[model samples]
Target: MKAIRIYEFGEPEVMRIVQVERPVPAPDEILVKVYAASVNPADYIIRRGGNEALKPLLKLPMGLGIDGAGIVEEVGSEVTEFKKGDRVYGVPNYLDGSYTEYLAAKATQFALMPRSLSFNEAGSLPACARMAYNGMVEKAKVQPGHRVLVHGAAGGIGSLAVQFAKAYGAYVIGTASAHNADFLKQLGADEVIDYNTQKFEHVVSDIDVVFNATPTTTVDEALRLRSVPVLNEGGIFVCTHGVWPSELFKGLLAKKKATVSMAGVDVNHHKIFTEVAKLIDLGKVKAVVNKVYPWERAAQAHHDSETKHVRGKIVLQIYQED
Candidate 1:
């Protein structure tokens, strides 16, 4: 089998397509003939060793992908939900490779591919879609009529966040560049702010919740939000990138400071991915695929995602069916 592996941490050049042994499924897992795979920010993060907590788990010359679509080649004895020849897509759990002709996945992380979508579209859903679902629905507890703001509105997670918030009936505000305003609006954002021309705080206020999808950039830009003092009292600010301990917030709470919460998403997506599949099946949501690359060009796929300007998901074709 062929797989994309990273030998060292640095630029996209570090990614290489190499020959590797085919993986076998666990008793509770399934072996899939991969049709396609999608690129996510986490793929690039793992490739560059940015997430230190995750480094110890990665084996050297590690396979670098999370989400993919495929047909079930074999199901483990312990698995009952899936069978050989079933069409599936999922986030592979603790594996040697997803960007390969054959990959293994835990049955828990997969769902039936939506009848309305192709393999490429299903490949684009697992990681980013689960991240967005956990953030918008579970953590933030976004409600209809609530005023919501999504940072990095044109990117993978942010684009889905916009759609989710809209479906839930929130008045959605999104921040992106001039080039993405129309795209953001098309995704159902009630208002799109060109972050380069105007700070989001200047144009919107009384926000009930702010979804910081681009936490890497949001920490520094937090100052830009101070100008807008109209956030609803007791409103929550969810910071996905930062870590805060209870002791760290004790003093701030004593001083009656504004509420700030640090959050981490569960990427397991075992159940959430199923729910997202339902949404796609029902036409309530869709994966936004901005670019597609051949499996051999996994390096270029990582490079494009690193740019941070990619409007939606980038997918890699692993195997083309007739």
Candidate 2:
């Protein structure tokens, strides 16, 4: 099997496409013949050795992607939802590998690929879509007519958040560059603000919830939300990047009379994951694929995602379709 591996953390060059032994399914796992996987900020963060907290957990010469779509080549004894040849998609357990020709993933982490989507589209859904669903539907508690604001709306999780907010009947406002204004609008954002030219804090108010999807490095940009009274009494602000520390964030929210919650998608959202797939299958939700790179170009795909300007998900095609 061929997989993308990082020998040492630094630049994207450290990521290499190499031949490796294939993974075997555990009792509750499934062996998938990977067709495609998506690049995420987490991928670059892990490759660059930036996530020191996760360092001990990441095996050296580690394989690189989390979200993927593939066909089930084999299923473990305990698996019941899927069988051989079933098309599936989801984020592999962080310890498992997805940027490979084959991956053995926990059966619980995956769902059947939406009937309406292709491998590439399914590959784009898991990490970002799960995060979006968690923030919009879970933490935000969005209701019809709620006003939702999404920062970095053109990026992967942000784009998905915009659509999910609207799908839940909230009025969505997204912040992006001028080039992405139309793109956000097409995703059903009620309004798109070009953050480069306009100050979003000045133009919007009374937001029921705000979703922060920027890379965790942008502390200043994330903190700036506090300057606005976007949240109503007891309203919540959801941070997806794990940006701020607990005590300080709690104090800040207290001062503003708002509550703050931080989250990353977990196994708890399996039902939402299935619901998202149902939406896609019904043509109610869509995967916005911005680019596709060959498996060998996995490093370049990471580079593109790091630029923080991608309009949607960037994917790597792992298998050559004949």
Candidate 3:
């Protein structure tokens, strides 16, 4: 099988295509013939060796993707929810990455692809959608008439957060550059804040929720902190720092009297995707794919994700549905 591998970390160029023996499924696992995968900030962070500072050292020959959509080729003895030939999508245990031809993971990590979506659309859902769901529904519990603020609202997870907040009946305010204001409005944000010209905190305040969609490295403390006073009492602030909130960020939350929670997809990828699939099938949610690349260009996908300029999600087409 072919897979994207990183022997050492530095740049997108550090990722490469390599041939490896196909993995076998364990008793509770399923082997999938990958159809598509999405590029995430974590993929680039892993490729550039940034994770070493926070997590354990990256083992050499690591794979480079986290979430993917594919057809189940074989099911483990204990698997029951799906069978061979089922179209499935979710984040694989990417300790080895999902940028590959074949991946084997515990069957519980995947769910049937929403019938209303294509392989590319379902492929892009797992991580970004999960993050959005985590922030808007789980942490914020946004309800009808609530005010929700989504920072970096044109980006992948941010865009999804905007939609989910709106779907939950919240009045959503999304922050982005001027070019994305119209796009955010189309995604159902009640208001769009062009951070390039206007400060978000100045314009959006007394919110029920604030979802941070910026990468931890590029997050502006002043802009993000300004949101502290912008919240209603006990409002939730969700961070996508790619890790837990920093001690400093935590202290700000404490001082502001707003509780802070790091954004996270549910650990049970299957269950969450199943819920998201219901939204997809109901036409309440859609994957905000910005670009699609052929599978072989996994490196290029990583490069584009690092640019942080993409409006929504980026996907690598591993195969088309047959």
Candidate 1: segments with Cα more than 4 A from true spot: 215-230, 242-264
lDDT of 1 by residue, 13-101 (tens): 88887888888888999999999999887777787775657767776778878889989999998999999998888888764557888
Model 3 residue 262 CA deviation (Å) reads 1.2
Instruction: Tell me the tens digit of each residue's lDDT in model 3 across 107-210.
Output: 98899999988889889889887788877788778899899988889988898899898888989998888999888888898898787889776766779788
Candidate 2 local lDDT, 1-322, one digit each (tens): 7888878888988988888988889989999999999988888888877575786777687877888998999999999988999888887876566888998878888888888888998898899888888888887788898998888888889988998888889999988889998888988999998878987878888888888876555564445445346666666787887556457666666876887767564536457678889888777679999999998888788788888778899999988644
Worst 10 residues of 1 by lDDT: 245-254
Instruction: List candidate 2 stretches off by more than 4 Å.
Output: 220-228, 245-249, 255-257
Every candidate's lDDT: 0.78, 0.82, 0.83
Return the candidate ranking by TM-score, descending.
3, 2, 1
Candidate 3, lDDT over the whole model: 0.83
- Worst lDDT window (10 residues) for model 3? 215-224
Candidate topping lDDT: 3
Winner on TM-score between 1 and 3 is 3
* C-alpha positional error of residue 5 in candidate 3 after TM-score superposition, expressed in Å: 1.3
- C-alpha displacement of 150 in model 2, angstroms? 0.3
